[model samples]
Target: MSYKTILVHLDTSVRAHPRLETALQLAKRFDAYLIGLYAVFEPNARAFNVMAGSAGYYEVQAAMRRERAGALERLFHAELTRAGVSGEWLAPGEPADRAVPHHARCADLVVAGQDDPGDPESYIGESFREHLIMSAGRPVLLMPYTGFFATVGQVPMIAWDGGREAARAVHDALPLLKAAGRASIVTVDTKADDAGPRIASADIAACIARHGVEVEMVSSVSDAQASAGDMLLSRASDLGADLVVMGGYGHTRLRELVLGGATRTFLESMTVPVLMSH
Candidate 1:
């Protein structure tokens, strides 16, 4: 029911500090063990040397990665000390797309950054977030690439559709929901077929209320042009929600991951932190 082990992904990008700050806040709040995992893409020395035809190219890259890792390790420890939290630092030299998910499986929650197209240093490949969500088997709290979130889980908005994924996400976020004291559950463009006949937002609201979280239900009818994801973001903005809880819907097709429309929208343009479980 509570997060005892929280793993955070750190890298050389400018957003790493903010991501770590969010993680630290959660660790302190939940009295959880914090893990600062330094995982990033390091070029394959042998392959890159063959392509570049320069023997020293790989060495230069390796040295730079090491330097950045050292700096980040120091920052992680200092922040943990300032926060008075117990944690450990890990730098497993491997591609982050693979390493992060591997380490995240052991934690109750995973804190990571949304992929930044503007920052090539932070790019681990296409569909990195999708891969993590689908493979982590745990809730992942993703921070936007461009924002400073001083607090999270204070005012949360839940995107509900009554599907299995949504149900999983709601329960996975129970800890934060209870801590927030209140939350808004928004259902956009709902159809009987989508959420079944008997289940309603009010029903889910009551369930959450039983857990001591005051809940409000908002049913919105999206315009023909506006997608469900757009409506969810708009509602989050109107409610001043600091965190959003929703399911990450995606499926593998032809060995490539294709995210659902709503999930894709949030990943690309989230105004607040999102806690997603698949």
Candidate 2:
């Protein structure tokens, strides 16, 4: 019902500070224990040795990585101290794509950064966010790569489609909705075939209201030129929403994961923080 433990992924990117700040704020708000997991991409030393014909380069890279990790650990601890929140730092020497999801499962919520194509330092791999959302088995809160969000969950908009994934997302975000005191459930490009007559936005609104959250239902019909993701973002901006809660839609095909069109759009162009669950 409440977030008791929050796991945040930290990397050697400029945006790491903002991500940590967001996690710290949530930790303080929920009175939860915070875990800072330091995971970054490390090139294969063996491959480097084969190319350079020497181990010296590998040693140098390892040493530099250690130094950066140590600095990040110190920063994380200091910030936690200043925030008066209890937390611990972890550096599991493993691929972030695997390690993050392994650690994230134990926490109630996971905080991660959106992939920045321009920042190679933070790149874990392709479809990292989609993989995390699918494998974490918990809600993931992703911070935008280009924004400084001092406040989250103040005014939230829920992207609803009445599917299983959307249902899971809405419930996973219940704590934030209750804390925010108000939320808007926006259904974009609603079609009778998509959401059956048995399920309606009003019904979900009533359910959320029972939890003491003031819920508003907003329905919009999107034009052929506009995508559902675009409609959702425009509505959020118009409502001055700081957070968006929605389902991360994706599926595996031929050992590759393909995110839904709307999900892909949000991951690539989110202006505000987004909380997604699969």
Estimate every model's Cα lDDT from 0 to 1. 0.88, 0.89
Residue pairs whose backbone atoms clash in candidate 2? none
Model 1: CA > 4 A from native: 52-55, 190-198
- Candidate 2, residue 123: Cα displacement in angstroms equals 0.3
* lDDT (Cα, tens digit) per residue for candidate 1, span 1-278: 89999999998888999999999999999999999998887666678757766658778877887898898999999999999999999887677788989999999999999989898778775688899999999999999998788899999999987777787889999999999899999875544455454346788888999999999887764768788888899989999999999989888999989888899999999989999999
Native-referenced Cα lDDT, model 1: 0.88
Where model 2 places Cα greater than 4 Å from the true spot, the runs are 53-59, 190-198
User: Lowest-scoring 10 consecutive residues by lDDT in candidate 1?
Assistant: 190-199
Clashing pairs in 1: none
What TM-score does each of the candidates earn? 0.94, 0.95
